[model samples]
Target: MSVTAAPGFVAAGVAAGIKASGNPDLSLVATADGKPVAAAGVFTRNKMTAAPVITTRAHLEATAGHAVAVVLNSGNANAATGQQGIDDAEAMCAAVATELGVDASQVLVCSTGLIGIPMPIDVIKAGIPSVVAARSADGGQAAATAIMTTDTVAKQVVIDGGGFVVGGMAKGAAMLSPNMATMLAVLTTDAAATPEQLKAALVYGVADSFNALDVDGCTSTNDTVLLLASGLAGSVDEAALNDAVARACASLAAQMCADAEGATKVVRMTVTGAASDEEALLGARYVSRSNLVKCSWYGCDPYWGRIASDLGSCGIDFDPSKFSVSYGGITVCRGAIDADHDAAAVASHMAGRNLEIVADLGLGTGTATILTNDLSHAYIDENMGTS
Candidate 1:
C-alpha cells in the first residue's frame, strides 16, 4: 500500500486495452469507507490542457476542493478531441461517482499518453465495474502500475508523521521540465486538515519537488498533482504534516528522475550564493534545461564551458570570473576558470550513473536545487515511437 497506506483510502488498477502494449492502463483511488475527503490539486498550466484535466479542475472548483475519488488512465491522453473529449472525461467521472455513491463533482479525472486520439469510452466504461469491485487497501501498487507510460518503475512513497501519515504515488519518465514536469501524482494523508490546509500543503510540496525536476524540458498537457486528506487520524501537528508531505513528494520526484526514459545519469544540480533563491533557481533551471549540458553529462565530459555559458545567459549579474563549477564534488573550475584539477579524474568521476553538479554564483546566500537526467538516444527512440 502506498497511496492506500493512509486510513480511509482504497485503490484499484485494471487493464482496459487502452495501451497498445496491453499494459494495465486504468486506475482508481478513492477515499473509501463511504466518505468524502478534503482534496486540492495543482494542474499543468499548459494552454492546451487535456479534457480530463479540464474536467478535474472544474470538479475541484465546483466542490470547493472536496473529492471522493480519482479516475486515472494511461496510454491514451484524452486531449485535443474537442467536445467529445470533454464529454468522455465527464462521463468517466460520473460513472465512478455512481458506482461509489458519491456526487459527480466529488470525482477527479486524469489521462496520459498519445494526444488527439478519441478515448475508448465504452471499453473503459465497461471496465469500471470490475475496477471498482477490485478496490482494496492493498491495491495501491496496482494503481501505481496502471498510471505509468514510459516509466520503467512505479513511484510511491509513505511517510509516517507520528499520529498521521502521508503517502503518494507518481508517474513520469519523460516529457519532464520545470513548471510541474510531465507527471501525475496523488498524495493521501490521514491527518485532520481543512481544505485550505490541504491546498497550501500541496502547493508548497509541489513547488519544492515536482516543479524542480526536468527530464526533457517538455511539459505534459495532463500533468496533475492532487492531494486528498481523510482526516481519520484527527488533528495533526501542522509543521509535521507539511514536512511529511514535502518529503513524500520529494521522494517520488527523485524516483521519477532516476527512472527517466533512456536516462543513464540522474543529475542533481545545486546553485548557491545567488542574489536570491529565485535567481538561484532560475540559474539552475537554465543549466538543467540546456541540451548541450545534458549531452555533455551523458558522455561524462567535463564541459565546464557549456555550464558556464548557460549560467551567464541567466541574466543574473555575477562576476563570471568569481563563480565556480564542480562535477560529482570534483572541483574542475574555480574563479570562473579551470581549477587545475586532473581532467581525467573529473571525467572518470562523472562516469557514474549518479552525478551531481554544483555552481556557486558567489553573489548572496541564496541557494536552490534541481533534479534532472542526462539526455540519451534511448529517450529519443522511446518518445519518437510512442504513437
Candidate 2:
C-alpha cells in the first residue's frame, strides 16, 4: 500500500533511462524549507564499497553532517568504477543542489542494481529538472518505488504521533544481512531533534531492526539508511519526540520484513530471559536466519528442534533444558521437551502472512526481538532466476 507522505518534504520519481525495464529509475527527495537539520546515515559494512557510498560518507562529514536533499538511481550500482564513479555520484548530488539553490555538500546520493557498472550520468542529468518538477508530499512513495531493483513492491510506512509525524520508505529483496543489506531507506520526521539526538535515535533503531535481519547473508556495498528531521512540528517535548521516532522505526522495520523477496510470512521472533539483552538478541537473530527454521515455517512444519539448535549455535550462556518455544501462542516445547500441542493447529497458524515465534531462555532477565521472513523455494527461484 502507498503511504501518504509527511509534510515539509517533496519527492519525485522519473525515468532516467537507467533501468532496461523502462521504469522510473531515478528519484529525488528534498525538504521544501531549504536546509533541514539532518542526522544521516549508516552504510554497508562491506570492504569493497561503492563510489556513491564512499562519496556520500565524505560529503556528510564535509558538510558538518547535514543534508537537505538526496538523489538516487537504480539499475546500476556505481561500485568498482574508481574515480570516475565517485565523480558521477558527486555530480548527481551537485546537480540537485544547483537546482535547489543549496550547497552541493547539503545533498546526498545513492545507487542500486547491477554491480560494477558506471552510472549513465547523461540520462540522470537530463531527468533532474523533471524529477524536481514532479515533487509533492506524497512523492516519497514514488521515490521508494523508483529505487527498487528486484523488489516486487515498494515498502513504506507512515505513523501519526500526536503533533508529530514520522514517515519512511525502504527497498530490499536480496543481498540482505546484518549491519547492512542490499536495501536503502530514507526516513523523514516532522519532529524537532538535535543532530546528536537524531543520530542516537537512528543508531538505536537500526541496531534493533535492520541490523538484525539476513535474507541471503550478503551485504551490499551501497546499503544506506538516511534520516532527516525537518523540525516542522515545532518544539515538542522529549517524550513526544521519542514516541514519534520509535513509531517511525517500528514502521520501517516491519515494512522491510514484509517486502522480503519471495517471503510468504513475516516472523516476529522474540527471545527473553537470556544472560543479557545482547545475548537474547543474538539468539533470536541466529534462529531468524536459520535455513531449516525458516523453511520449516514455509512448509508449515513446527520443527522445534531446528529452533533449539539455532539458539544453541549463538554461543549464548544458556541451559538447553531451560529453553522453551512457542508458535502463535501454542507451546511446542517446554523445558527443552515437546509440549504435546496440536500440530494441525500450529501448522495452520504458521500458514498465515504473519507468525510469532517466542523463546524463553531461563538464564537471566534480558530480552530482544527480531523480525524475519519464512524462507521458501520461491525465494530461491525469484532471486536466482534470470530476469
Candidate 3:
C-alpha cells in the first residue's frame, strides 16, 4: 500500500504505448468516489517548465487547490513542445475528467521522461479509459512503478498515523537537486485539513526532504510534488499531521537517494555551527554538489581537503580556524588542520555503502543535513544516451 494506504483514494496504472519498451507508462490517482479533494502542489523552479506542470498549476489555481484526480504519463516529458504540448496536457486532464464526470478544472496532470519530445497524445488518450476503470485500492504500487524513468526500483512510503494514514510514492534517479528534484510524487492522507494547512505541511515536509537532495546537482523541468487530502478521518491534530507528512516525505527522499542512478554509496552530509540554518544548508550543499568530493567518495578516499575547499568557497561567514571535518564519527580534520587519527580506520569507514560526513563551523547554533550520492562511472554511462 502506498497512495491507496490512505482511505478515500484509489489508484491505477497501465501500459499506454508511450514508452518504446512497452512498459506501463500511464497512471491515475483519484478520490474513491470520484469527487474533488483538497490538493496542493510544489513544482520545479526551472524556468523551462514542462507543459503538464504549467497546466496543473493553472488548474490548481482555478479550482482553489481542489482536484478530483491526477493523470500522469511517462516516456515523454511533454516539455519544450510548444502549444501542442500544452494542448496535449489539457487533453489528458479533460479525458480523466470526462471519465469521472467532473469538470476539467478539477483534474491535474503530470508527465516525466525524455525532454523536448512530443507526447503520444493519441496513445495516452486511448489508454485513459482502461486506467480509470482499473483504479482500485490496491493499485498504488502499480501507479508508482508506472512513473519510474531511470529509477532502478519504485519508491513508496506509508506512515500509519493512528487513525489516519499518510501514503506517498516518488520516482527519480538522476538530475536531482534543490528547489524540488527531478521527480514526481503524489502524497495522500485521509486526515481532515484545509487547503492552506495542506500547503503549509507540504512545504515544511519538502524543505528537508526532496529539496535537500543533491544527487547530480541538476534540477529537471518537470518536478512536482502534490499532496491530496480526503478528510475521511476527521479532525486530527494539525501538529501530528504535519509530522506524519514530514516523515513520509523523508522516507521517500531517502529511497530516491539510495536508488540514484548507478549510485554505490549514499552520503549524508551534515553541517553545523553556522550563522543560520540557511547558511548551514548552503555550506552542506556546497560539499554535496562538488564533483571532486563526490568522486573522492566513490574512490573511498578520506580527502578532507576537498570538503574544506568547498566550504571555504561557499561564501558563508565562517572562521577558517574554527572549521572542522569528520567522517563516520572520526574527526579527520580539527581546527582546519589534520587531526591525529588512524588513517586506516577512516579509510575503512569510507568503504561502507552508507557514508556520513560532518562539518562543524563552530560559529553558532544552526545546522542542516543534505543527502547526496557518490559519482560513479555507471552514472556517466547512464546519461550518455539521448533516448
RMSD for all candidates, in order, please.
1.3, 2.3, 1.0
Candidate 1, run of 10 with poorest lDDT = 174-183
User: Runs in model 2 with CA error above 4 Å?
Assistant: 1-4, 385-387
Tell me the TM-score of each prediction against the true structure: 0.97, 0.92, 0.98
lDDT of 2 at 2: 26
lDDT of 3 by residue, 205-296 (tens): 99989999989889999999999999999979888988999999999999999999989999999999999999999999989999999999
Each candidate: what lDDT? 0.88, 0.80, 0.92
Q: Count of backbone clashes for each model?
A: 0, 0, 0
Q: By TM-score, is 1 or 3 better?
A: 3
Query: Who is ahead in lDDT, 1 or 2?
Result: 1
Q: Which candidate number has the best TM-score?
A: 3
Rank candidates by lDDT, best first.
3, 1, 2
Q: What is the lDDT of candidate 3?
A: 0.92
